[model samples]
Target chain A: MTGGLVYLLYVLFAVGGIALYLAMPRTQGAHAKAGLVIGGGAVAGLLALCAQVYMAPHGSNIFYYIFAGVALLAAGRVVTHPNPTYSAVYFALVVLSVAVLLVMQRAEFLAVALVIIYAGAILVTYAFVIMLAQQSGGGSSADQRAREPMLAIIASFVVMGTIAGRVSDLRELPNSPVEVQATADVMDVPLADTPVKDAGNTLSVGRTMFNQYVVVVQLAGLLLLVAMVGAIAVSRKRIPADEHGPPPPPPGEIGRTVPPF
Target chain B: MLLAFTQLGFSSILALVILGIILGMVAYSIYFERKIAGWVQDRYGPNRVGLPTLVGDLLPEKYGKFHFWGLGQPIADGLKFFLKEDIIPSHVDKPLFLIAPCVSLIVALIGFVVIPWGGQVAIFGQVFNVQVANPDIGLLYILGVGSMGVYGVVLGGWASNNKYSVYGAVRATAQMLSYEIPMGVAIMCVVLTCGQVRLEEIMASQVAGWNVWNLFYHPVAFIILWITMFAETNRTPFDLAECEQELVGGFHTEYSAMKFAMFFLAEYAHMITGCAFLAVLFCGGWDPIPFVRIPLFRPEDTGIIAMLAKMAVLFGKVAFFMFMYMWVRWTVPRFRFDQLMRVAWKGLIPASLGVLAVAIAGLYLGLHRTLWFTLPGNVAVVLVSLWVMSRAKDPVSGREANLPPLTRSPELGVQA
Candidate 1:
């Protein structure tokens, strides 16, 4: 990446980290309004910079900008909102925005699947848990306080910067014939915007998944099955305290119990 | 207006027309629901609310005296909702409370965009679909939108700051989550049988063959979908969420005026959409007759008159389902919450899975569309499920055995 762009990225990340730290709820108080303004500006600036550098080749799409903005803003809310229920709702908004962005890329199957699995199913379960668990109006003290905000912000930003730097450097590479051949060799089919036809992207995706990546898909299903089994095993364990005692130990102290199974 | 509509395409025009039609249907469904309830209970419903006196005076005596079978009631009710005091409870989440009804109504309304209401139509030498958007994943689109409908209930209940509202919302969340599995599996059965995800293609499959509907192939799935539809729409006997005897007014208890009206409109809209989905998936979407395609009702007949006739047929099926909704609402008593859960988990889910398995096996054997293969398979599934239910040892309607036994109590002499 160029020195100027690198410097801008640094500035943006620094401002955003500070904004998130300020916005995160604390025991005393939080400057949420100020944090929101600063964070929004930082995010917008970062998006603009990315657009200028990466998306300059493709003409600017209004929908792309709008949905991306919404995704980023709602993602911010999901992290920084004090109310867990509202956080879950904001996460749904983020899923919706991302789904729209996927649609803009002509990944219609992925877009609808994302909406179905994330916004429709997972977020509903999240809202269910948050609503039932959070009896208070605003939020619990755990939700009202950020744990090690500085360390998390720094670690996440560092990783993000590294990835962004690597992507930009790769994008800056010369489009040599050898490089194109390598890309074709790796992908089998060259990456291009194939105009969607009668069967649409769904057929293409399903064919590729089942034909080429069948093993990977089966492995993913196996992983999910293992996770399900693990969850069932964990939940089936009957701790003595849970059945007969007054009340199970509070949340943090639950590690004290040993699983009989 | 004509020029604008031409520029926007027929799909946009159809969308506007469908929106108007659905809103009107939603209004009248409320009237019909009350009328049906009244009929079931041997009492008069809203027959007295005729035309307003001001409008009545302006008309001729003959026309003014006409009651129009209480057709003016929905209009009056709409006006009442508009003029009624819009009350937002003080101790509530203001933003969420305001957004919930709109979310509910919008999600309910948008699901119809993918339903092929009248198949293809020929207009001004151009062939166009009656549906607003014919996405490849049309069935999945409907399922996704229907799944999103639960958010409104949960949000409204949470925002109401009432215990009953919370209970109602919790029940709604759990119920929707439970019933969606069976509904999705049932739809998958249709998809496997047809080998298509597009609603129009699926409709064409039933129309092009022996002209038999998917319901004939998978009656068990149809029955499962029918039961889940009531649960998904939070209707009786699955409407444990808003059972008046327990939770007063349920999730919308604290809502007043237009907000309450919006929730009511959403429920009716959801019913209409669910009915349309059922018609599209199992019944021939726009075919008037299932086993026999009449002359003008064939899929190939794309004339304007034919299109209108097909639309009427689709609406007829939808209306029948809507009537059934009201019929079941008044006839069948509400299930207890535990019973509702039992019906979904033990009854619908297992039965739907069986139907899905039969579909897959039929597809594998290249007899997915044949009556000989699918019909017997569906019947067998029903018989097996019945046998299993008969053999089950546990009572269906009682406290769950999974719950921890009562703790030891010295005074009460109860043991763990």
Candidate 2:
């Protein structure tokens, strides 16, 4: 019943989830059903986000909640799902939606940068893992790194859960952020129409963040530069087990094992 | 939650309404892109679609050449995407793939929040502001959201479980990221020079004057930003993702029907935002010219003509950039993968830092305030940038294919 488009998004996906659930075969297929569960759960999660977003007033930071929440769900799927490829992709999406959330919060510049960096470079690194890092044994159709991701998800959930109470608690949209943040909850009393006294100080602090705090920004830049270079350097060509299929031909034993036309 | 409608006064509500109107305008933007593209490619475009001929009426003439081609096309296209089946590949990491496009489109929509679209306006009785959010961190918002196109492509590609799609996603993500550094630096120069981050304030600060058209101020930075824009938008030459000759369908290959359309729609939406931001930063943003200095036509007045005029000029500038995108796409060829990286990291990064260094040096030396031989020192910085570009090595080259297959990209047989 809200204006944030909750019903349109919720109802649309609710129908899709139900349809997908019903479409599942009676035979309990691990991968397929795992897929349906992960997918249906995500749709449900998205619906929740849409509902929240729809219910939100303009300028509300509820969009951040929606973004971070859905991102958690996305990252969750990559861990729970059976396929490594799907996991990689879903994991990438988790970072991307943050960019979206940032943009919606009027951080388009950072949003774009996040997209290029996390979604672009980081995802490529993941892609390389899938391509080059096959195990000694022939990896199955299902992702063999299932345990690693499962542990990661659990570890991540624990980390997030500790912060969840405060994080999920809606961050307020303060008009004058600097002064407002300092006074917002310290006294447990809201300021109604009382304009903060030191507007100039807030501007000065903000300017300092860009200028005097330039070193941290420079460090951030360096870290990203390192990431770019590191990704490229690490992704060098190595002898792939998949390229030369299974049975151990001795190193000197070449001819028959090679791709013979 | 619907408190926005109930609790908030008219201005915020008016902002919401304007947001909706702009979105609707963006929906019709497809018609704009296609119409422009058609013109650029020497075609008639959607002229056959009649001008709303009683508001989106078609289906009476399916096969006819002018079956409401001009007016009804965007409508028809909009309907087609909505009505089409939403396909979800079984192999995809189902949840993320489903969410990526929406996330992308939403982020794309969000950038307009900080943009002072119609400058400002007044409603029935009380004054209503046009922009949705005028945060202290307004310009940063552009950098934040404008870059989220990577997610849409990456997720779509990664989730699809197709090799080509994944490859495309990776390439797109990498290209976007690589270009963003210089792009960020270039815009920083613009914002830093202006001395305000808030959109409204930035526009107001330019009352004295705009910053050198910026393209002229830092030519190398300007050129780098332009190239980054092209790469950022996944336009041709930088359109390595969807390169049919290489990676088929790029990130959206596995997506079909409405889901596929979401990716398609998101790309264009993001493209428009790219153009909008470009216009906002360099081409005087909402300031048509610095010294309009009219007393009656004040900064945030509600005169219909002035608002319309400002909107028209801003809209015109964005459209010109869009046209340039199409023109460049048609004129240029795609860059090779290494070539693309070489340009962004090797060329743009060093050059951008050089520009930033000059700016910082100028500030410390107090050269910025000083006008040399009647020209501002910043103007001199701009001229020097042009000279450096003239001397810089041109990216693509003179001769071809003399190298042995052992050298660069042994996969493609180039000199390593």
Candidate 3:
């Protein structure tokens, strides 16, 4: 990547940061309209820059463009939306479009699993919490205003810039035809034309997971189990008297049952 | 007997045809729900709404007056819905409110595409499948789409800006999340037993050479799936979200006109899709008999007549399942909210997990398809679950362990 292109990328991120800071919901001074327009422009500029740099190496499909655009747009809405419920809903849209993008890359099982877990389960829980919270206390000042917007935006943009720099560096790797074809096979080919290719994809994923990554999978499951146990322990109710260290039950009364209501 | 259309064209045409059939079925299912309610309560339903006046005039008076068992009532009901005033309440979130019903209807409609209505049809010497699309992850696709149904109800409830509506949405979210676990586990049982994730392959496994339907081998899983299906569709026994006595029409309380009708249509559409999916999974889809595969209706039989016969058989199974839905709705009373949660978390989830375990064991034993291994395994799981439930120590109605200890009220002379 050229020094000029890197500078241009930084400029775009700076513009996006400004737009996002301006767009963050507030109780007064509605600059949302201006912020949204500026943010959209910044995003489009970023996309164009990326397309110019990478479209030659990665032969573009129209669906790749459409779904990726929608994912980015919805992700922006997820952050900028005033209402928490709407934010969660926009997040679901992001999940869906990203899932479609995954499917285009022939990760059908992973794509559907993403929809089921993230869009279906996690986002619904988020929406539920937002709805319950809003009912209890309708739109607090905390929800209405962004906290330390400039610092947060700068921090995130710095991380994104670093990743972008690294990605650009990847383009200079030994561009062997075999590696190029492998990359194209893994990333560029849409599975819709030959769905038969997908039949083996799931099987291969399962085989690889259980064969090579079996320990990793089991450890992940164990981590989840530990988290669940911790959650249950934290959420369990304790009587006020118990905080003062109540005496143990008498020997004869040990394991005594509580009467049903 | 076919045209000059390409295979893709024919599939597209079949997709349209299936859509039309499903819409028609949805319209009539509502009528049948009412008719079944009437029958259960010992009264006639929609008998007054015969053919339209224009159509009646073209027929003889006696025949027109016969009412044709209220066959035209759905059409009349549909027309009324169209003519009615569409109301958007002032307090609601307009965008989400508008999108909710559409989401509901689209999610409901899209689930049927993977359901192989008939095995295959030979058209103009070309073999075309009688399905919209048969993705490799067909069953999971259906599950994913079914999970998406939560969005419509949640959005509708939230956007209604009513307390009852919010309550309904919260309940729906919890119920769907809870039931989906057992539902997925039950499906996993089927996938394990058949060693196939594709709906057509699953069906083909059942249809191959005197093989029995999955219902016989995994009866416990079938029962679990049946119960979870009701919860997933928000039908009675599990319709806590919109139970009229408590939530006052629940999520659709604020909906009216075409929007309300869309929600109504989506419910019936969900029923049809769920039933079709259940048939494809547990019953030998498009195979007329379980143990005995008739030569004419075997899945391999790809003639036009065979395809039509297979389609009729599949539709018949779907209709039977739909009827069971209505019958159960009328027969069983709705569970209390806490009881509903208890049933899912304590009862169905464990049972489904056990069923999945049995399926895994059956697979390992190389008797997944055999009646002896699976049937007895199902029976043992059911018996064990029942025994465990009987030995349970907690209160039956609610989560008492989490509640604070009751205090005595001196004035009321009771624990509060």
Candidate 4:
């Protein structure tokens, strides 16, 4: 019956959150509204998932906390109200909720990352834009661009769909029966012999990541670094004049550069 | 073969349904945020869709009749994005730009695979893990997968081929990476306390009493967590990416049609994911089920009913935080860029370090293993954080500063 009560509450909050989103302001279209609904609803759903642990901690339901917590706090401003400022606060709450939940899960690293990466970094940027948005400048004025290309966009979406579909379909690789065996191996080892259990019971990817999975973690880091470097290199450019870009430097400045001619 | 192909046997199906439901909720979140903004700001929101179009007589007298904004507004909005002009400006870096939002969206969607939504469900005389993919590495995997999203933002901003986008990109990366330090510190406190990283075990350990509410145990850490989470999600005063006053859509300015929609969609996904994370970490995931005495409904049953109940609790918590996001956005103004940076560097980082320090102290003192201590410290931190929020300056322009001229345009300077 408690489960039913829980669902009842979930329904109420989900509706309330959606109602809140629906009650916001927008001039351009429904995307904002829909986005808020989807975002707010997901957060509401994730929160409900966490409430279960609070209702009964001893009941074997803790495992769900980690993932639920990770997802819960993801919503920043899509719920609550439409104002970007409101969204930012909601976003912060999402981060806080995730952080607290992760702490509870003992996934210290992940919890911190949620706060650091999502709350700290992402939300900060969001607040910057929302605050900086011009009160009068036309953000949606470009809707009138004529004869817009369609095929390429469709193709891009298709590619995304296919790749996503493939990733989703990868269940065929079949998780190694060994994953379970590994769990058993850890369980069977003498308490004294088991390094992880003795080390605060924190069986982190960090630990094994440093031990067995060190190479994997290092490789992923390397890839991210490479991407960052490439992004910096590619994004840098001198603005051009009359070439349909940000206005360029004044005429006399170009020739002052090392007298190449 | 199909049964065997599942990620976690019978639970995979359940996981998908739950995830789908969550995604649907995310869509609605966008709708409501707008509606509430209209009402709070004293404007009618999307009641246009709920209007009776057939008679056309109910149209607002402004349009010559009383009308309800269509209830179908959100749906129409979604369809419009899909069918709208899809354009990628010629100057953009095509590959990464195209890939960015999708990557972010997929990553956000995938984070759900490991969450213990229903805990465990018994099937075919065997109890199966009620998660999509409960890898032994688990919690770490979430960190690994979750952070992949930042790349999407960075890449999207950079690829848009606009100075504003690039600026937003740089700020985003800096903001995200800088705050990561304190976030990491705060997390260490939790780890020190729990002594375990496995999601299941962590939850199991909390069975004694909702983890004694982590805030009370590690008050300093809680403060750090709240601050860092704000920076991480890029909401509010921090939302510099699309600052129309300056950046003109920031990273997504050039995007048109469904592509733009994808960016927004991924954002909502990120928000939901963040909220769930908070619910699980602080509030106690799925343990809010009220007292139950029925023989089959024992806390030990770990049955479908239990799973549903747990989902309900977690979901509610997640929604509350989501709602809080909107409430806050309206209530608080943006922080000036420098102020935002200071919070990361001077404010949150140090506070997080303090949390780390106390965590280590308590660790050596065996606080997690023992507990009921540090209550006073937590109260102090909470008071301090509340005080800080109250005193923190708005981002558009700090409370202490003269509003800068609009045209000098430092890009971030808020014109008075």
Candidate 5:
């Protein structure tokens, strides 16, 4: 009964947040928009609190709450921010917050990898593109305006509900023999023999990736190669004239009467 | 609550000390850079500024004339920056413009946290390691934070609402993206050989042993790393981002006063961090010298005096690298934008990749235990790659045909 009440409250808060987002004015008064965003954030935070209270008996520690809050806040800002450049910057913050969470989970390799790959390379490139292509007058008209806001809000809420339902359903299922055996196999690996003392986690991760999922790794590498080639081909500029076109007259002769020769 | 207070107090004290030392080093590094530049140009650098007026008045006339070889220049410069007018252009993105320099300086400062400076020292019956944080992924943390430095440059350029600044930011983004690949690969060679990502462990592995320093075994990787460091730090010949001839002041064009000073400080701080990283990775952090076994200078030598000496050694190496940076800045001509990209993508990337391949092959052939096989293998890889590179068509040269010829010849002055 408590879980049902919590779920109902979560739905109500989510809907109210979406309504506030949609009701925000398009122009002239940024304060109203900011107020709406704050309202949405408060509702989202309450929903998260409700979900956490309902799902976990132990309740997450302070660090988990802090990182999760930062991640969610930044992620929200990334989508709602009007300026594309600020959006990209907020995306980096999201990546950083997520990296902190991953570190908390003892997945240091993944955390560092996310920072290096997403925040470092990918988001930097995104910022470059946004800055380079930014239109005059702060931004393009489309940037200041949201399209089909009502539809977008509803669709996003539906997706969120579906994911929440799926997660709750998975939580109720009993552990099967195959799942237990798979976990046991993972636990059986001897991580102590790695050369580096403090790098056993990374070593074990690498071992599992290469030994148990070698084929998947190879496929990923192959996919990256294909993507690289495709990107080059797609972006390569075509020469204005045919390669075998008639040779132009000599430079000095081009503008002179002797060009006929 | 008491326990938390103690932990927090200890950390806060340590952080304050480290911050103070780093700031002092950064200030002196600017002075050091100017001195090197002056020597390179055959001129006497700032040698006039000294004590404040009050202190000068208190001293005897002769003593006041000393000036201590202009040691007070950086302090004076800092004061000047503070006294200057802080300008915020009306057209600028106000918030981002204000935050950019702070971001740059903060990111630069954070990269030093994982650097094990003095190794270990005994004090009052307790052993203490002189590092802010000794995470297992120390090297990765440095790389991660180091990469974020580009963001500050990009944002500063974008927020300035100037074309030149945007161009500068674009060039920085491109340069960083290109150089990072080879840099990562070079670091991989070190990590593969040491089998450790921890900076302290890497340092420990190199002390008083055959293949003592990573520089000997990974000579090619070291060269690649050195070149990438120049690119990474935006030093010549790769400082296309802020090239005075093209981009004016680059990303910080519109910045003034303390904000501009922050960008300047950030650059020096980054150089210090990069030099320290190189010292730690290849030169053996806190090790007196490669393959030289001083009686009291082993990794296990945890005496306070020994730790001090180790710190001095690391500092000396970092200073040498910093000096090398300034020397190269005045020595090498800046690369053209296209040429810079070619050097990174065509030259350094393939060279580093070849070295990585050779290292992996050596490891596979059971050469991981010693530098005996790996050193030769690396040398062979470098030579082979160089030969292959020379045989390939020069991409930069071929592209020059598309450029317009000079309209007015120097001898002719101007066409009639």
Candidate 6:
């Protein structure tokens, strides 16, 4: 009976948060809009807290809870923020929070890699794109109004609900753990020979990748090369003179384009 | 909770002390730079600005008149920055503009965490490593944190709402991204030779004999890394981001007062960190000169005095490199944008790659960590790569074919 009550409360917060997000006023004052988003974010955060409490009673580290809460809030801001640049910046916060979680899990190499690749490279590129595209301030109508917000929220929430239910169900299975452990062992056979002890964290990861998963690593490199070539081909611009003979300029225009210092 | 409090308190105190030292170093670095520039240009720099009247009055009359060769200039400059009004331009993005300098300062300051300053010291009754944190992935941490420093420049430029600032930001991002590849490759060579990623271990590995420094074996990699350091720090000859004549103040065009001061401080902080990294990787770090063999200053020595001596050795190397940075800044002309990109993509990248291949082959043939084997191999790689590069047609020149050729005569052209 108590489990049913908690489940109902979880659904209530999730649905209410999504409803508030979808109902944000497009034409309202900026302050009012910001207040609405903040209220909605609080509701979503509460929902995450409930899920965390339900999922792992043993995992009660305060730092973990704080990081998880911040990650969820930043992810929420990434999607719902009106300004595109702010959204990209918020996405960086999400990346940082995820990195902290990775650090908590003792995956130091993966955490640093996440920061370097995603926060360092990808997000910088995203900021550049945002700056290049948005010359004016972010007061565009597209930014102001969310297209099909209700549909997006409902569909995403439904998927989240399904995942949450499946996770809870898996926690109740007794024999499922043994079966999962067996599968994990089978998967670990290739990496079993790699020496991890006495090696630094990064060295171990490098050995595992090179020794056990060399083929997959090579494939990933090949995929990156192909993508780079494709990008160059698609973006290359040809000179107009190559297609058509150079047109003669007017008689007096020979030095018109040159600027005088 | 008590355990957490104790850990946090200790770390926080250590962090604050380090921060104070770095800030002081940055302040004096600006003074040193100016003095060096003045010496180069045949003029006195900041000789007039010493302590104020109040402080001078407390000193002896003779000392008061001396002015200490302008030692008080940084303090005065700091005061000026604080007293001036911070103007957030009406047209700029307020939040991003405010956050940019903080990001720059934070990222630059944090890159020093993995740098083994004094190795280990005996304090009170216990021994402790001098570094703030010695993570297993120390090298990668430095690279990762250093890379994030570009975001501060980019955000500052974009938020300024100016054409020149945006252009500067774009150039900075491109230059940083391009140079990082060669830098990473050069660092990989160091890592492979040392068989370790920890900075202190790398330092220890190089202390075997005189001329055993990584510099002796990997001269080409050292040269590449040195050039990339100048570029990464945005020093003169590579400071496209803040090219005064072209981009006005560059990314900090609209920044003023203390906010602008943060960016300036961050630049010097980055130079210090970069030089420290070079010292650790190439020079023997805190190890005494190999041939000199001063017993008190040896790498194996421990205790307070030895730690201080080692730190002094490292600092002297860093200061020498810093002077070299200033010397090059005054000597070399800035590279054009196309020339800068070509140097990285066409020149350094291929050279570093060749060095890597040679290093790998040396390791494979059971000559691992032998300077004698790798030194000649690296020299050969450098020469061969340069020869190959010379044979290739210049891409920049090839692009000029699309433009119309210049002509001086019409009807009576000499060539026609």
Candidate 3: lDDT over CA atoms? Answer: 0.84
Worst 10 residues of 4 chain A by lDDT: A252-261
The model with the greater lDDT, 2 or 5, is 5
Q: Give lDDT: candidate 4, residue A90.
A: 60
Higher-scoring candidate on TM-score, 5 or 6: 5
Model 1 CA lDDT for position B95: 88
**Minimal lDDT window, size 10, model 2 chain B:** B397-406
lDDT of 2 by residue, B259-282 (tens): 777676666767777776777666
Q: Candidate 3 regions off by >4 Å? A: A1-6, A56-60, A136-139, A169-199, A238-261, B1-7, B53-64, B398-416
DockQ of each: 0.28, 0.09, 0.30, 0.03, 0.35, 0.38
What TM-score does each model's chain B reach against the true chain B?
0.92, 0.79, 0.93, 0.82, 0.91, 0.90
- Top candidate on DockQ is 6
Model 6: colliding residue pairs:
none
C-alpha local distance difference test of each model? 0.85, 0.62, 0.84, 0.60, 0.78, 0.78
TM-score of 4: 0.58
Q: What digit string (tens of lDDT, one per residue) describes model 3 on residues B148-183?
A: 998999999999999999999999999999999999
User: What would the per-residue lDDT of candidate 4 be over residues B1-416, giving only the tens digit for each residue?
Assistant: 34564435465577668678777777778777787778778987776665335455745567664334555666778888988878878887687688778866786777776666545665555676666665554565555555555656766776675778877776776677776678767766766777655666555555444335454567677666656666666777677656667788777778888888877877777777767765555555666642223343233676666667767777887788788777666667877577678778767776676666666766787765444556655555567767877797654423222322224333545354
Residues A1-261, model 3: lDDT tens digits: 787898889888889888888887877896888888898888888878878777754437777667777787778778777788889989999999999977876678889999999999988989989998886346457776777777888898889888887687677653333343345456544323433333354655565466556899999999999999999999997565345444333322222334433
Q: Please, what are the lDDT tens digits per residue for candidate 6 over residues B1-102?
A: 334434335446556776787788899888888998899989898877767765655778866556778989999999999999999999998999999999
Q: What are the models' TM-scores?
A: 0.88, 0.66, 0.89, 0.58, 0.88, 0.86
Error at A40, model 2, angstroms: 17
Please count the clashing residue pairs in each candidate, in the order shown. 0, 31, 0, 181, 0, 0
lDDT of 6 at B121: 66
